[model samples]
Target: MIERELVIVGGGPSGMAAAIAARENGVKDILLLERDQYLGGILNQCVHTGFGLEYFKEVLTGPEYADRFIKKIRGLPDIEISLRSFAVGMTGDKVVTFLKPGRMERVKARAIIMATGCREKTREMVHIAGTRPSGIFSAGFAQKLINIEGLLPGKEVVIVGSGDIGLIMARRFVLEGAKVSGVVEIQGQSRGLVRNIVQCIEDFDIPIYFNHKISRIYGRDRVEALDAVRVDENFNEISGTKFALKCDTILMSVGLIPENELIEMAGVAIDRKTNSPVSEELNKTSVPGIFVCGNSFKVYDIVDSVTRDSLAAGKLAAEYLGRARA
Candidate 1:
């Protein structure tokens, strides 16, 4: 029956940054909860060096970028970090239910930070007509499997989104010795950056198909091939435009949605647009003391931006507890 001044749900860049800011601004009895065995979220699997260009003015790997906040919090006494703890449920009664190693615990907090990040849109969401293959993976999930677990998702791959993550994985899979058949996009213009298109696709001689989509996936136990077809302005398939590619893997990087299941359970009003708890400029949710930030608030393009947004949430949460937050 312990109580906390503030409880931050997540341990990614935003949650870590918020806890650090709250501690620095004189908040006490603050707790940070993470579901994974470690602190960083998706950043733990991103080994490439492109993050932190704006915040730190230097290129850093994703893990390195997350480390910048995590290391600082290690020295703070006001913050308690709960690793392997999942913040499962939230209620309007100001109670949070979480599970640790073996036991479930409940804690009441004066204020809460919902910093859970983003979720990848899957093949079902994209409506890709394909066999249920084992090799198909979301780009981020593939990144985790490849980089974190040191496993190769497939030997040959066809990427189905010219997104930042999908394109990046094109390079990553190549560097890992997988042959990239091509990158295909349903949109006329790519959803990724120009630099990524140049570096990951063009430089590698991996062909890119615009105004195209994966219409079907064919295989038995594992993916053996896939069909890419051109779509009309109305998204209806253009006849006689189907092309098949031989590959064992299909990587999808369609879109990101904010994670807000718990935010909804808390009886907080969420924006259908951001898919996050709706808040004003002060970042306060419809519920009196609940707040949200980072990708949980909106699908931001950069982690550095998420960190800055978290600082605002931390300040506002502190202010609610009678601490004059900056």
Candidate 2:
């Protein structure tokens, strides 16, 4: 068992920012844990620019944005980083048990911050009627496949959501020499940013079928074709509006859910509306000594907002430790 004044459960944008903020605010003992082998979280896989525009006033890629913070985090003393670590269990009194390398370790902290990020919605979550196929993937998975692994997911792609990831991936597929048949949205309006809609879909001349959905998918072993249908305002498929889109791949980017299983286990009060922890202050959760920030609090449209929110969380966490000591 290890004892620390503060323990951050994630090493993404929020976690890194929180640790830095806490250290600057006089929190001496801090430990940051990440499940990935490195820090930066999902930002590492995001290769696109348009990040840090609001925060840094410069156009940058996701890695570039993360690197800026990581550099600062590395320079801070008394802040330890543990990679390839996962918080598997938590006690009622704020003790966290984690798995790292070949051993299980426990850390008791005066304050804890959860910046666990979010998870992409999958085909199973949407219940898309289709034979189990190989070419189907979440937009995040496809992004990681292309950016990190240097591999294209497929030649022809049909995106099933108009959210940011799906929209961004539509352009990525085109840039990578893959044909994006269309971007389909079940809702009438796009759920993504206006710039993404214009740059990713409209700019590429990729068809966007609003009030439409992929009703069914067809393939034996891999994706061959999919059935697209126009839906009414009520989201019911209209008669005689079904069409076939021939594509080798389907990317699902319907939604993102906050990763808060451990927080829930710790008996934190959750906001029913956001499905995230109920935060009264900038990042203070209902559970005292346990702060929630970033996507774990509520999904932010931009990374700049995440950093701002997490900076406050870190400061508050430091204050919490200070009060405890006083």
TM-score of each: 0.96, 0.96
* CA lDDT of each prediction against the hidden true structure: 0.89, 0.91
> What local lDDT score does residue 174 receive in model 2, on the 0 to 100 scale?
99
Model 1 earns a TM-score of 0.96
For candidate 1, write residues 248-276 as lDDT tens digits. 99999998899999979989987887687
Off by over 4 Å in 2: 323-326
lDDT tens readout by residue for model 2, 37-131: 98999899988988888889999999999999999999999999999999998765889999998999999988899999999889998877978
CA lDDT of 32 in candidate 2?
97
Report the poorest 10 consecutive residues by lDDT, candidate 2.
Answer: 317-326
Q: In model 1, which residue pairs have backbone atoms overlapping below 3 Å?
A: none
Quote the positional error of residue 261 for candidate 2 in Å. Answer: 0.4
The predictions' CA RMSDs to the true structure, in order, are 1.4, 1.7
